[model samples]
Target chain A: MNGTLEISGLSKSYREPVLDHLDLTIDDGVFALLGPNGAGKTTLVSILTTLVLPDSGYARIGGVDVVTSPREARRLFAATGQETTLDDLLTGRENLVMLGRLLGLGRGATRRADALLEQFDLAPAGRRTVATYSGGMRRRLDLAASLLTQPAVLFLDEPTTGLDPVSRNRVWDDIRALAETGTTVFLTTQTLDEAEALADRIAVLRAGRLVADGTAEELIAAVGGQRLVLLDSERNEVRSIDTDGTAASLAHAMSSLHAHEQGLHVALRSPSLDDAFIALTQTHQEVAA
Target chain B: MTALAPDRPSSAHGVGPWRSSGVFIGRSLRHSLRDGEGMLMAVALPVILLLLFTYVFGGAIIADGYVDFVVPGVILTCAGYGAASVAVSVNRDITLGAMRRFRTLPIVSATVLAGHVVASVLRNLVATMIVILVALAIGFRPSATVLEWFGALGLVAMWILAITALFACIGLVSGSVEAANGYGFILLFLPYLSSAFVPIETMPAWLQPIATHQPMGPLVEAIRALLTGAGEAPALVSLAWSCGIIALSMVLITLALPRSKDR
Candidate 1:
């Protein structure tokens, strides 16, 4: 129940640094590492999951070092990688059963397999080979296989990367449900809304470093309140001005002719994770440079 | 976190010591069985080669007793070739994300390689039996006693196990399933180069020494001797080669398994 993931001063590089001395600690709940492509989200998950080693520092799952004591750390979590690990030749149920047995489930493997199949709404397809299943079904079954042993933590690396919207929501519900049982869920994603919706705490990673870490509200607040924008015909912003959502600020802002232009598109926008990400990382990169 | 000790089984649910191997081996065997085309090819390739050699090339190359002489080579070659397919299977698993999940699990991941090797050996045994039965139908005969028959079977199984392990290592290090297939094909041709098909003496003079020196030559020669009662068993040398290959493959597998996802 005390499941927590902690990584400190962790770094890894192939040609260039993929993860640069990154540090973060996450308690039991839904924690998301949000980043764009090539921001080292997968690399960090690999290191934390013990699939890849770091050049230096340490990563731990439930206080067990993933690098120094990977086998021990492995006990605390099951990872559903970007690629679904389900065997295409095997049935969905068989895939779960195999993992169950491998995790030492014995005869109980079948029971667990059935339970997971039903839980993931895969019982109907459980007998069908994975090769015959839809992409979403395979992703769901992949999640089911990971939960066969019911480890304390679950690591989802881009779990819904190629999923349909409906499937993505189903997986999101599953992650949420697992965390409700006091199981820690560590996830990585590029979708801002996914992190804002699912993660109790979110860490924004940019070029292998933590640019921002906070709740969704905190991140949005950090970016600023709201924006008034004058856009060109292409919807590209021509002039942007920040303003409080209050009518007084809007009235005062509209009073300026410098902000008004003929045939200009006018739009009021609320700050989102995208704005925060850009603002946070833009400043961090500038400072670093 | 770095100071923690190895935890009690996340899998205290494991029934016994053999559970890991049992589960993985079953998984592997089931995979082999389900691949109907692959399974068919495993059995048919050897038999087809046997027929082609015994009828087409056997009479032209030898002045009689050709069927008897070629049967041993075909049986061993079929099994070796079948076992070498482990490289393709193993590489598929690696490329398909099976290994990525395995590494993150609580089980001894090395059992994955064991599973492939064991399954290949078992599957090859079945294919070898069918090949021999076909040989008998085609006037091929072996003069071995019951003890020698068992010895021949065991030798073939050992050779399969060793090559399967070696190919499994090849699978682990290979970047792609196609690449693994290409590498395994290199070893597959060894049977043709060595005495597995024709006697080494029939080869060009310069090529004879190379054929005689390769492991397949000693191994096939040993099995041929046991099957035909043609000469003394030089099986100790074949056994040594099998053990060495298995040992070296095991070490390479361990080294490669952990680093598979790194690249």
Candidate 2:
């Protein structure tokens, strides 16, 4: 597939099955895995990043088997987990330099660290210990440390969960820049707007299984038509026509109906990505019921 | 874009994995040095204990001479304190997610543990020197030769390793930093209650037997033999006890280490 990630029959469970025979592939772009809380997204990331082992599934990164050659596979990837793993005792610069050294960079590790600090806009606060850093700064430093090796595949688990909108946008810009450099980005997030804004491809996971996977536009199209409404009698009381629940169809229905009423108020109810997501998942829930 | 470009250098002096391990070790040592409270405790506690014993309790306690009686005991006690520090530091690191971060890194798993252990040894050596200087200042003198002094230092270093390993294992099993601290204090306290502080003969008859056979007694007596040219047999007994503790603790720590899933 010429992809960075390939997983098959990836099953992992602690007492009960968390991921049930899950399969997924991520190619050379930013892919967002969207799921509700406790949908095993973190577990999947853990297994994929070699932080946790799956019971029966095999995973490969850049065509290297993660199980037998984890050291080799680890060289090609970096993961920023949901948990804050940065050592509080170390300065932000020290943390980056340590990671660089661990990744086999020698005397030039400090130079790389300085560059990363500057890139992340953390050069001013880089000398202060991480304990004194704000949550957003620590998050940025954690992201910077993970990039010390410049891994081909980067996994960010809920990177912007606690970030303000401005900080989140800044991180998103960094992620985009990384992807533009041919680095494959794998991220899981609960923010629909984030996924909509950044994801080249999106996969919806419910209860550890892939319910839907496609481009955002394709997924939106698959959810069906929109509703169109027109008020014929009064401003408050409106009579509707062609309420199919698709944006394009609703726009056509509204325009066609708008011509017929002289004093009528018309509106188009186009289905949004949020609406499509809720409708699709709710339908799946109903079928399961 | 050019700045972000990978700066692949020539392979003439390519750094290997072992060199990376050395860097990790150096990083850990730097962390220890910067830990203000830890550095204070590692340097100050042993010297305080030595001064308190020699000045406050030196006159009453006698087995040929006070320096002869107290030096061995203080060295062993300092080794015990060193062990406590190792346990506390290791436990704190684990609880703070430092060990977990190290596990996820591309470096060898054993490197982090090795770095901390070596740092602990070096810290203890410094503490030992301070204690010796303080003892000399207080009119205590060693009867042993220069070679014997070095031999004594070497034995105490080995003793620190054994004791530190045991406490490090305890720290691993401990659920929290507080628990590890408490456990380490208790481990160090055991040596004080044994013959390390006072003569076993001076204790109650029932307690005397337990005090003589305890780990600290043999280790302290061995240091005493080396420092004062008392005898070689006691040193052999001390070496045996130290080896036993080291072997047992290593096995326990190996088993106690968390698996990838647990982390």
Candidate 3:
């Protein structure tokens, strides 16, 4: 199928293997690449951004080969990395202007800078040097700088890892807005909540290869079964139930218990994205073992 | 919070590569201007050296003439100092992630380095002018023609480029700003030990050969040759050394740049 991002047999290793023969496809909208630490999410982002070279395989953004014509491929993408990349020597506005100029904005760079500052709520501190900016402000400024180019595809590599909930939500809103404008966003995050909130399609990666790829609902269905269970406790209390296995049997058991009016608390287990994630990963580990 | 709206199209004017690079260079220049203490050091260090050598040590050391002798030394000192300042700036940018941001842009990497080099050249020229004015005020005069003055200035600019390239490479390889500063100070001091500050012959016999062949030694000799019309071959020697060092450093830096695999 035609995709906004197409990767095949991609491999990269630094000393030890980071991304092993991995393949995946992402179309428009926010696609979240989720993995735990050292899963090569950042490595993949770096390669896709033309900042690092992969040892093997190829990636195409909007059908432009990233390795072959990096400059042209870069035109299709912008990235905000985990570390803040704002120039501390310049003011927030000046940093944006520099980015705009580098992106070929010319005299219009200043206008764009001002607009970005306003959009990112940096207008109040636009004149202040970035050295004085707080962590959240710097991150916001960094994100604003990346958007100055307005690439067809944007990469946010763990954009909200260290942010407070409010700041994270702010970034999430900005990301959602970008997607609403039909900008393809490829974000990598260790936070499952972030993935659930922003990603229309989620791909779970382990040791560089995609272990699972689907919408949250699709993944949940694939894992199978919704179970409702109860455990006996003292004083006619109900305890936890394991929701792994057949849904019909669990529901029937729950219904029977309810019919009896036994003093019980009910716990229902439908396969969630988290459960799918755990099952897929554990199965892979068991096979490897 | 305001909505995260994409910018509206306000103009159709797009910048070409040359204009964009110019803006980058101009912005860097403006940053240096705003740093008053930095500007002072760039102008003051060479002037201080010139005065100290010409007044305090001029009597003890014999040369063709005191002002002419000290002028070349001071000029080389200024150029060396200018290179160190560029190193500090570059190191700061690397540390602050400015270089990382620049690398992501569509602009060529060479342009960013070139912009910094141009700024260093310009700053060196200003520093040279300040030193000359101070020397003139203290009764130092060059009997050479305007063409010779221009030639001397060209040599100084070339020396600054060479030195700055070497130090910029150091900044690239440095692990931290503190390490860059320490190494830059060492590099700056190397020129002082050469003919730039004291006569090479005044040193121990074993050290004379090393001092005489140093990059700054020939630069000082060349500047002195042009300033007093002394006709020394030191300028030619300086030119060769400067070009070699610059070429070597640029190659190493380019190699280091691509090999940086930090995600």
Candidate 4:
């Protein structure tokens, strides 16, 4: 019954239904919430982080009910909201130290702040105010602040939404490092690439309801198998074959193609996570529509 | 690297409300000190008005003892108007997601407001002193007992507490920092129209009632009485105004704070 995160009958509505009796369970590792814009990703994160409340049902983190005992539950998780929730006037080091102290680190707060600054490769800019730092630096500082207490469950709400590719990769590396240490990171992203790259388990949400939940490969397989393409040099055209990831289908297609042509090319096109996500969302949209 | 291991939050211990408040208060104070133009305006505006009114308008406005009469009024004006910056500060925090971040933490919710209140009160105290010292340097002398001086200080403290709470609430409900600044100016203008700068009787008949009956008039009169070693009536009236403002603002702030979410 106890998991890293558990939600049941969790429903919330404002004007229209934002979350409709959504249920989810996660064991550990990086679990990503994949949805398009207005799919209630941020709203779910808001409720989990205790910044907002659900109208009905409840959510639990590590066996503590977030609605009934938010203060106790707050101890188990740290969140970096969609926006950069930082005191921009304060220097980066000061902001981290302040968070550390608030998390009950006491004198060790300074040491931790210093270490985090260096680890984030922001040691030179640590002394500068966050207002002066670039967007990527601010995101790194926000992440650093959230990790001040090294929370058991970390909620990152689109942590790299607006970052450049280089900065995004840097944040991705830090996220991986945190997971390697056994911190369960629950992230939400509209970008399928982000989810495919980082998530151990991916949940596709459509219109406030979960449409699919599985590993990347499983979802991809369920949606559709990969394609096998055969090119004939003389005709200057390509022929296609389908594979259910079986050696028999590939061998049969290859044998038929090889007997006919002197010059032939063959390739296998595996279904990408993007294909799975699109298929899942389109299926849900058609049903809802 | 393993160096990251040492930076973790030691043991997941929680912070007490008072400790969290102290940290926030320290941050608020640091912010105010670093804000050069705002700090200068908050501290120096009253002193400037005191000198300007005492020398420029003193002879024409008063028959005698102009400096002594206007100094208390100037101080009261400063006390009443000091909340503009507090409004800006509080509004900035709310609108910029600082308070949102704080709410997600394990610290007590009241701690954020407490820090703002403490910082506003301390800044008022220092600004009041600067105004008083400026009054002294300009040859304004009051023949009051030490106890009367203490009374003046106490009344000023209460006055600051009331106005800061009121303006902070205004800032909280305001749509933006610019709107909060506009509200703050309205508060700053109130004292000027009251007995803070001139006698209520000297105003036009229609405005006289407002000038005399509003909170600032009583507060200024009370401080003037204390400084001049006059009677207790003004002090009593001032205390009533201070308490009324504090109570009303507290109710308004409580009502408005809930609606400020996501703003």
* Most accurate candidate by TM-score: 1
Off by over 4 Å in 1: A231-267, B1-17, B259-263
Query: Which interface RMSD does candidate 3 score?
Result: 4.9
TM-score of 3: 0.86
* iRMSD (1 decimal) for each model: 7.5, 4.4, 4.9, 3.3
Best by lDDT: 4
Q: Please report the candidate that would top DockQ against the real structure.
A: 1
- Higher-ranked by TM-score: 1 or 4: 1
| Order of the predicted models by lDDT, top scorer first | 4, 1, 3, 2
Clashing pairs in 1: A104-B13, A104-B14
Give the Å shift of residue A117 in candidate 4: 1.6
TM-score of the B chain in each candidate versus the native B chain: 0.90, 0.87, 0.88, 0.91
Lowest-lDDT window of 10 residues in candidate 2 chain A? A238-247
What is the CA-based DockQ of model 3?
Answer: 0.30
Candidate 4, superposed: residue stretches over 4 Å from native: A1-3, A225-268, B1-7, B229-233, B258-263
Model 2 misplaced regions, further than 4 Å: A1-3, A225-268, A280-289, B1-3, B6-17, B57-68, B229-233, B261-263
Q: Candidate 3 chain B TM?
A: 0.88
State the C-alpha lDDT per candidate: 0.82, 0.76, 0.77, 0.83
Q: Write the per-residue lDDT of candidate 3 for residues A198-289, one digit (tens) a residue.
A: 99999888877788888888777777776564655436655544444665666656655645544556667676677778887777768768
Candidate 2 lands at a TM-score of: 0.87
